[model samples]
Target: MVIPVLAIVFTLYFFSTILNSPWTAQVSAFSLGSLLLLFCVIFVAKTVYQLRRGDGTLSFGNIVSRDDLASGRVGLFLATLGFTLLIDYLGFTLTTFLFLLVSMTILARGRGFMRITLVSALMALGGWAVFILAFDTRFPRGWFETTMKAVLANG
Candidate 1:
């Protein structure tokens, strides 16, 4: 319920921020945000209905338990935080690769190191190819992107 409320608030705020942008820029944001807001509203309504019917209680007891801690949730959260913080400096591809590697390691309980590394590398490269190379998005450029651009331009 709390998550849905927060999502609703944030989606509205996101919509507000994009109002002054061009329609092209606003199109994707508006579409995605509207869907998020709709789902959040539905969730909130369902939770409220359940509460009114005496099927639920407004308790935070189950929100964060020992099981959640043991399940690597904290580690995954930290990895995400690190991705955001380092993206500007490390650039999209490298930061995404590192984030995925760390997150997969945490979720896999440190097993399958080779497979995780390969998948992370492949995913990072795929993202670079699609979003950076093909779409030419405004993501920050690091050594790999810079080198790739130079190689492509020369070749």
Candidate 2:
């Protein structure tokens, strides 16, 4: 319930910030934020309904139990945090690739190393192509983007 409420608030705040942005930026932000806000509203409403009917109890214990820590939740959280912190320094594509690789590795319990690496690389490249190349988003430029820009310019 708290998480959903926070999500709603964040989505609204994000929408407010994007008002003066370009149409492409506004469209993408609104599309994703609206869905987040809608889902959060629905979840909060359902939780309230369940509470009123005495069908469910709010338990914060399950949110951070030992099983959750053992199940790679902590690793995923750290990976997400790292992604946010490192994105500016490393740029979007490279940071995204590293984050995905680490996240997939954690989720797979260290299995499928080769496949995870390949998928991560492909996804990072695809994101670069779409967001950086097609949309020309303001993602920070690093080695990969710089090199690609040079190659494309020369070619």
Candidate 3:
């Protein structure tokens, strides 16, 4: 019920933005897609909670009490969004590596720092190498591109 309302509102908002703003259709589509995905998750979570409770209503006590809990994923998501913006300014290889490292660190609880670091680095480096070398795809040239170009010039 609430999810449907929010979804309608978000759709209207996006439609208005597309009509009024100078942003390209792709950008508006992406924004609307994200909003729709968020609503889907919200709907799913609510449904799951209701099913788990065996009641359609979540208790007021549960909502008032558990609202204080800080979900760590919120911070991780904000970091990822920032990293995405950084990609336009810092390039894909560097941003992807840094974003993956930070997100993995945050999500890896009770894990050894050394192990996490090694795994994150290996994954990030291997992904970038494959995309750049094998696929021959061009990524954004961010702030680090000049330095990368210099290094690759020598290689």
Give all candidates' CA lDDT scores: 0.91, 0.92, 0.69
- Model 3 misplacement above 4 A: 10-71, 143-145
Global CA lDDT of candidate 2, please? 0.92
Q: Please report, as a residue range, the 10-residue window in candidate 1 with the lowest summed lDDT.
A: 60-69
In every candidate, how many clashes are there?
A: 0, 0, 4
Q: Model 1 segments beyond 4 Å from truth?
A: 1-60
Each model's TM-score? 0.62, 0.62, 0.56
Candidate 2: list runs displaced more than 4 Å.
1-60
Estimate the TM-score for candidate 3.
0.56
Tens-place lDDT digits, model 3, residues 1-155: 55465676777676766675566775858676777867777887787888898877544554334333254465577778989788887777778778877777766643577887777778766766677646757877655556756788899
Q: In model 2, how large is the Cα lDDT of residue 84?
A: 95
For candidate 2, the per-residue lDDT at 142 reads 87
Model 2 TM-score is: 0.62
RMSD (CA, Å), each prediction: 7.6, 8.9, 8.7
Task: For residue 77, give model 2's deviation from the true position in Å.
Answer: 0.2
How well does model 3 score by local distance difference test? 0.69
